[model samples]
Target: MQFDKPATTNPIDQLKVVGKPIHRLDGELKTTGRAMYAYEWHDKDVSYVYGYPIGAAIAKGKVKSIDASAAKKAPGVLTVVTTLDVGDLKKGKFNTAKLFGGSEIQHYHQAVAVVVAKTFEQARSAAALIKVDYEEQPGIFDLQAAMASAEKPDDSQEPDTAVGDFEAAFEAAPVTLSETYSTPDQSHSMMEPNASIAAWDGDALTVWTSSQMIDWWRTDLATTLGIDKEKIHLMSPFIGGGFGGKLFLRSDAVLAAFAAKAVGRPVKVALPRPFIANNTTHRPATIQRIRIGAERDGKITAIAHESWSGDLPGGGPETAVNQTRLLYAGANRMTAMRLATLDLPEGNAMRAPGEAPGLMALEIAIDEMAVKVGMDPIQFRIVNDTQVDPEKPERPFSHRDLIGCLERGSKAFGWDRRGAPGTRREGQWLVGMGVGAALRNNLVMPSGARVKLDKEGVVTVETDMTDIGTGSYTIIAQTAAEMLGVGIDKVAVQLGDSRFPVSAGSGGQFGANSATSGVYAACVKLREAVACKLGFDSEDVVFENGQVRSGNRSVPLAQAAADEGLVGEDTIKWGDLTKTHQQSTFGAHFVEVGVDVSTGETRIRRMLAVCAAGRILNPITARSQVIGAMTMGAGGALSEELAIDTRRGFFVNHDLAGYEVPVHADIPHQEVIFMDETDPMSSPMKAKGIGELGLCGVSAAIANAIYNATGIRVRHYPITLDKLIGELPDVA
Candidate 1:
């Protein structure tokens, strides 16, 4: 089923089960702790040993030598395999830095060796006995110091959008504002760390690992091991959380496979907490400069956004200027990004990636520009909203309602009650409210699935789609139920297996829509198959109450498959629909904060997010996603930052104890409202992603609220109390 043009009326429009608020089908397994993670896979026929990995000490250099004789003699030590023993190997196409093999140390915490033992404690204790010597070399660690050497990245996703003369338009405007802002590099810090279990059956490898993309990891793992892709199997049944951290192949799987082959036994490896920061990818720090020119009437005439970020040699830029090219109405607009070479751990996607950090700066600048023009922030944003692409006017947004989001959010949050900066007083605390617009691109990938109908009138859907706390299992069941005219109880969903048909995999806010669309395509095929077997025309064959009806004739759906079950397999292919339409999701964030006048400490009082992202598949799961993103936004605004060691070229705070995230006690009253809308251009399901959209610009709303409470402006991210302490008024 190729989705080239806009979708028309389909079976999903029935509003039977797809759009209802259904509880997650996997909730029982999670609540009862019956779901098995990567390291907990049990097999009675085979016993699993433990492999503990040792990471590289030096950031940039070559391994001089390794003395593992002491580790070999340690208790219960089966084998110790070093990188030098493995020799040179191929790097995966998606990876910027090599995972393992050879003597080169590309970054800190690069796996150098793994110690296999009879028990986890034995392997851990034996790994400490091994000694490694490295030749050190200087590497770039600071983004500001390396900005001069940064060069333009070859970006095919979105090249710099330039129109009309930005300089002339800016110079001629009556009210203009220019400011620079910075956001720090941050960690994913997912609930479950990277872990993998590998067992080889005569060169046929099977790995139970925590991976988001099954095919990508299988292909890459085969590349790293110099084996055929068909010989390796990978699956991740349940994941605690990923946030783009486990989207690719990690060292834990490779180390486990190598150790299992060496010892001729299955081995399980789990990366220690200290390695999660220094050994994996992170959201790179960015320095952005934004210039906006507007008239006294609050119409934007010119807008330019430029950003710079540092990463390993072949890594791409942070793409922090993505939302700037299309967020508001700016005639003469320009957006550019530069990538710098740094020797730090590879910088890649975390949370929302580009739009999350970009909005953190752009939205705050919008608020500041609103003040310069003497208008309310929400009104200023509403007046500048654009229904079409600001850069390319020929293409219009498929569905957009940013104005509605702001207007509705304001009425619910009592925006009119918001007063001037530092004027609203509550005992020793000052209170204020702020608003910001949210946007993230709508991405679609080709996905495939297989649907099976059993003799008992049960439908089963098979796909590699993963549920990384985004409710893939629930929405998938709902899609199949709607398509086959059956209740969700009759649909069984099996996911995260290599043998299953390939899916979009969870990332970039594209997984839910793309994966379910694949299921919908397969179910459509099954409907046709059922109609044919029952000697009925395909058109207007209404299936309901476990019966297939055509004209005055009706047959039990199970009777169509009296003995053998029917199967339908298909993949959803996409054409140039995205190119013809400017597809994106929009929302608004309203935040209220109270700051202690004397201590400069901030407390979040209330939060609300109004979203307009097409159809909501299941309101119960969608709300879970939005609230989780809102909590992450609170962390990004207040306390999340990866403490860097410049001289050492690694994350200094390598463990969760030092890395801070939001706790339940830290958050306050929160609410979310989804606009009653759907985009026919998105998919047959008519739904777009809302998880990432829930996060974009939320931090800026918090920062703006802090400024409203205390007249201190913070241009850098993680707006700590120290940035406001000296600026506090004498008596407030």
Candidate 2:
């Protein structure tokens, strides 16, 4: 079913299930510990061997020699597969660094070998026996230091945007503000480590792994192994968390597959916590410069955003300037990205990739500009809001409610109560309030699914869509239930299997709408099939109460599938609607914070996010996504940083003890409100993604709140006490 045109009135329009606040359908399985994650999968038929990976000691060097004789003689050691034995393996398409680097190590802690044993403990213990002698070489590990000789990245998704004359307008403006902001490297630090179980029978390989994109991993795994794509089966039934960390195939799955094949037994591998930071992908640090020229009336006349980031060779820039090209109506605007070569763990997508760090700078710049002009920050944003894309005025937004969000959020947050900085003091606390506009593009992707109706009138939807704790299972089931005119309890959802129909695979904030639209397309085909089986006109058949009715005649849906289960498969093909119209989501984030007058410790008092992202499929899960992302954004603003030791070319803080994220105590009351709205062009479900939307401008809000409280502005991220302590007022 092609979604070439805007969605019309459909069964989902009934609003009986799709838009309701439904609890996660997989909640029970997850809470009861019945759901099996990759490392936990147990098969009675296959004797499981364990593989512990050994990482490179040197960041960049040639391996002089590897003494693995001690490991081979270790107790229960089945086999030890090293890069020397594997030779030159094909690199996966999505991988930037070689997974099993040996001769010349690309990065620190890159997996060089795997020791397989009868038990995990034995494999880990024997892995310590292997000794690798290396010749160390200097490598670039810092983004700012490498930017001097930076080159344009080869695989950048979006180059840059420019309009009119940004330099001239900025120079002519009487009121101007220019500032630089920095965001540090961040680890996904998902609860579950990268793990996989691989078993090969003859030429066929089956892997149960923890990944976001199952088919992408399958094809990449096959490519890495030099095997037939059709011969591999990948399954990821449940995931603890991804946040873009599991978007591609990791070393664990590939290493386990090869080790299992070598040992002639099924093997499971899980990367140890220490290796996770330096071995896998991370969100690259960025240094961004934002210049804004505004009139005395607080209208933005010129805006320019330039960002510098570092990644491995052949890797892409973070594209941190994307939202700046469209978020506001600046007559002269420009945005550019410069990429530097760094050997730090291959930088890649993490949550709201481009806009996350981008907005951290841009939004704070807006706040500073507003203060410079002696205007309200919200008013400044409203004065510059663009109904059409600022880069392409010919393209109008499908839906934009940023003004409404700010107005509503301001009222709810009591924005009028905010006073002058350092004026409102309670004991040793300086209290202030700040707000930022949230913006993220609404992307659409073609997705496919298969829906089956059994003889018992039960509906089952099959797609490779992953839940990833985003409630994909619950929302997909709700979509099918709404279409079939049945309760959600009657709908079963099957996901994360490559054998199932391909889906959008849960990335870029397009998964929810695209995957559910795929299910909607399949359900449309099923409705037609049911109509044909009941000898009724396909266009006029109505499905209700587990029965299909046409005119005065009705038949049980189960009767149509009495002999065999009915199947319907289709793909939701997109048209040029997205190109014709600038589709995007908008929101407002308000934060109230208290800064310690003496120590400069900032703590959030209250927070609120008002979103206008098409439709809300499940408010419960949508709110959860928003609050969770808000918490992550708080960490990104105040604490999270993957500190790199440039001399050693490795993340110094490799474990959770050093890499801090927000605990419950770090975050305060968070409220989320979704505007009552929907966009027909978004999808049949009329929904856009909220998972990443919640993260968009939250850091900026916190930073603005800090400025509001202290009258001191810090451009660098993780606004630590050290950065603020020196500039703070002297308290006697």
Candidate 3:
């Protein structure tokens, strides 16, 4: 099924099950601890060993030598495999740094060896026995020092774009504001660390891993291992969380597979908590400069955004200027990104990626510009709203309700009651409210699925789409149920198995719409097969209440199936619809904060997000994603930062205890409101992704709220108390 144009009335439009707030079917298994993770998978026929990885101590240079004799003779140690032993291994296409073999120490904590043993303790103990010497080399660790040498990233997804003469427009504008903002390197901090369990039978290998994109990992693993893709099978039915950390193949799976092949048994590997930050990908730190010029009447005339971040040689820029190019209407607009070579960990996607950090700076700049022009921030945004892309006016949005989101969110947040900064006092606390616009691109990918219809009128959907704790299983079941006209309980969902059809694989907020649309396509084929089996016209047949009906004739849906269940398979291929339409999700985030006058500490009083994404599939799960993202955004504004070890070139605070995320006590009330909307251009489900949309601009709302409460503008992220203390009035 090619979704080339806008969809008409489809089975999903019936809304019998797709839009309902249904409980997650895997809720019980997860809460009860019955769902097995990668390292916990048990197979009675196989004997499992433990593998502990040894990472490079230095950030850059070559390995001089490794003395592994002590580790080979250690008790319970099976074998030790080093990068030198494995020789050169090909890097995956999506990877900027090598995972395992032939490591020249591209970054800190690059795995150089793995020790396999009978137990985890033995493997760890054996790993400690192996010693290596490295020839250290000076590497660039500071973004500021390398900024002069930074060049425009040639491999960037979207290169620099310019519309009109931004310089002239900005110089001529009466009202203008210019500011610089900084965002620090941040970790995913997902509950489950990178883990994998690999087993081999004959020449074929199977790996159970904690991964977000199963097929991507499968393809990359084969490439990295130099083996046939058909010889490998990957599965990850459940994941604690990814946040984009587990989106690609990491060292844990590769080392585990290598150890399993060497030991002639299954091997499990899990990265210790401390290694997660430096060993895997992180959200890169960014330095952004934003200049906005507007009319005295609050219409934006010119906007320019430039951002620079450091990464490995082959890595791309952070793309912190993306939202600036499309978020508002401006005739003279420009956006550019540069990348510097740094010896830190590889930078990759996290949550909303570009938009998340981009908005942290862009939205705050918008708020500051609003104050300069003497206009309400909400009104300023509304006045500059554009239905078409600012850079490409010919490509209009499928549907945009940013104004609706802002107006609705402002009313609910009591924006009219907001007072001057540092004027609103509630006893010892200073109160204020702030708003920021949310924007994330709507992405669609080719996805496929297989559906089976049983003789007992049951439906089962199989796809490689992963849950990543985002409710993929529940939503897919809902889609199959809606299409087959069966109760959601009667539909079974099997996911994350390589044997199943390939799906969008859960990243960049495209999983829900793309994966469910794949199931919808499979169900369409099944409906046709059922109509033919029942001797009825496929176009006019109706599937309802587990019955197939055509005109006055009706029959049980199960009667159309043979003794064996009927299977249907199809892929949802996208054409030029996305190119023809500028598809994006929009929302507004509102935050009210209270600042302790004496301590300069900021606390969130309440939070609300108004979303105008296409039809929401499951409100319950979608709300969970929003509130969770809001909490993460709060952390980015108040606490989260990956401190750099300038001397050693690594993350200083690499563990969870040193890094601070919002706990339950730190978060107050949070409310999510989704506008009633549907976009035929999105898919047959008429739904766009809400996961990353919930996180897009939330951090800026907090920053804006803090500024409103204290009258202090903080350009740096994680607005610590020190940044506010000097500006606050003396307190008793």
Candidate 4:
């Protein structure tokens, strides 16, 4: 079913099941350890061996040769396959760096060989026997150092956009602010590592792996293996966490497939945690410069944002200026993104991606500009809210309540009590509160699902959509239940198998909206089928309480399909709705922080987020997602950083032992509020993506809060105490 027009009063508006705060459907399985991750996949009849990978030591250059003779003769070793065996294979569409089977070393920890053995310890022991010789070459590793060589990336549709003359407007403005901010490389650091189990039977390959997009991995794995796409079967029913790390097929899947094909047995491969950062994708570091020109009354006149980032060849830019072009109202505006070729690990999506880092700099700049204009930061953001696209004035936002988010958050957070920077003190701690506007583009993709109603009256929905810890199963069950007029207990959901209908598949926070819309479309067809079998006009039929009613006649829904199980399969295709309407989610982040005068350490006291992202499907899950993102934002502001070794051209701190991620214990209390609003143009569900929106401006709010507490502005991220120690006030 095509969503060509604005949605009207649909069956979902009933609010009986879809909007309720229902408990997560998969909680029991996860809590009981019954939900199997990729590495834990098991079968009764099949024996699976372990595969351990050997990585190249050099970041750039060619692998001269690999000597695996010792590994092949090692005890319990089944087989050893090197890059030389496969030769440079065709790269996949989603992959930036070659996963394996290539002599050219694009980055450190690029898989060089895989050792298969009867046990994991045996495989690890044998993998150490293989030695690789490489010819090292100097590589570009710094974003700031390579700024002059940065070029406009081809993948960015609009690498540069300009409106009215920004220079002229900026020169004439009474109050202005210009600053440069930096965000270091970040790691996904999700709970589940990239892992896969591969098996082959008569030239047909099957893989059970951790991936965000099942069909995407299937297609890409086929490409990398140089085999027919039809011969591959992929399954990923449960994932502990993704955060965009498993969005693409990593070396685990490729090595497992190759090992299985070579040894004639199933092979399981999981990347060692220390090798993940350089072998897989990471959030590239970015250098962003923002300039804002505003009137004395806080009306923004001109706003310009430019960012530079580095990645391997053929990779895309971070696009850190994306939100700046649309977040606020400005007559003269400009945005540009430059990409530099650095031989680091491939840079790709992580959580909110472009908007997350972009807001880290843009929102802080907004706060600085507000201070210059002598206005409250929340009021300054409110004064610049735009109902229409700032760059394209003719196009209006479908549903924007940025002002509402700010105003509501201001009152709820006690914004009136906020004092000047470094003025509020409690003993040795200085307190302050800060606010930032949040925005994320709402996206939709073609998604399909199959719904089946059996004689038992149980509805089963099958789609390739994945949960990835964002409550896909709960919300999807809610959608199917609402549409079929059944209780949540009566619906079963099967996901993350290539055999199922393809879905949007859980990334960029679009899965909840687009994938559920696909289920809604299939349910629409099922409803029609039930009406036709009951000999009632489809439009006049009413589905409720497991009964089909028309006029004075009522029949049990199970009776309509008693002869055989009924089925409905459909895809939700969109039209030009997004073109006509600027679809985006908006929110406001408010954070209170206390800084210690003696130690220059900052600690968050409490935080709140007011979000105006369309109709929330499940308040329980949406709140969970928002708070999770908020916690991640705290890490970004305070401690998360992938320490890169410039001379080595690799992330030095690749393992969790060296890396830092904030937990519930580290973060203070967090509250989330969703505005009661919906956008018809979004989808049949009328719900927009809210998870990423919760993260967009959170770091900046924290940054501004730290500044307010200490009266010291930090332009760089992960505001470590080292950067503030000397500037901190002395405790008398």
State the TM-score for model 3.
0.99
Tens-place lDDT per residue, model 1, 1-732, is 999888899989997999899999999998998988898888899888999999999899999899999999999999999999999889998889998899999999999999999999999999999899999989999999999999988867464779989999999999999999999999999989999999999989999999889989999999999999999988898998999999889999999999999999999999999888888888999999999999999999999999999899989999899999889998899999998999999999988999999999999999999999999999999999999999889999999999999999999999999999989999989898988899999998888999999999999999988999899999999999998888999999999999999999999999999999999999999999999999989888988878889999998888887789999889999888778789999999999999998888989999999999999999989999998998999999999999889998999887878988899988999899999999989999999998899999899999999988886779898988888887786536
Q: On a 0 to 1 TM-score scale, where does candidate 4 land against the true structure?
A: 0.99
lDDT of each: 0.92, 0.90, 0.92, 0.92
Which run of 10 residues does model 1 get worst, by summed lDDT? 152-161
Task: Tell how far residue 81 is off in model 2, in angstroms.
Answer: 0.5
Residue-wise lDDT of candidate 2 within 605-681, one digit each (tens)?
99999999998999999999999999999999999999888888999999999999999999999999999999988
Model 3 steric clash pairs: none
Residue 297 miss distance in model 2 (angstroms): 0.4
In the range 1-732, model 4's lDDT, one tens digit per residue, is 989899999999997899999999999999999999999999989999999999889899999888899999999999999999999899999999999987899999999999999999999999988988889999989888999999998854578999999999999999998899999999999888899999999889999999999999999999999999999999998997888898998999999999999999999999999777889999999999999999999999999999999889999999799999899999999999999999999999999989999999999999999889898898889899889999999999999999999999999999899988888999988898988789999988889999999888889999999989899999999999999888999999999999999999989878899999999999999999999988999998888878889999999878888868899899999999888889999999999998888888889999999999899999999999999999999999999999989999888888888899986678888999999999998998999998899898999999999888888899999999888788875421
Q: Model 4 segments beyond 4 Å from truth?
A: 730-732
Native-structure RMSD, model 4: 1.0
Please identify model 3 stretches exceeding 4 Å from their true place.
Answer: 730-732
TM-score for each prediction? 0.99, 0.98, 0.99, 0.99
Candidate 2 lDDT score relative to the true structure: 0.90
Residue 536's lDDT in candidate 2: 94
**Model 2, stretches more than 4 Å misplaced?**
none
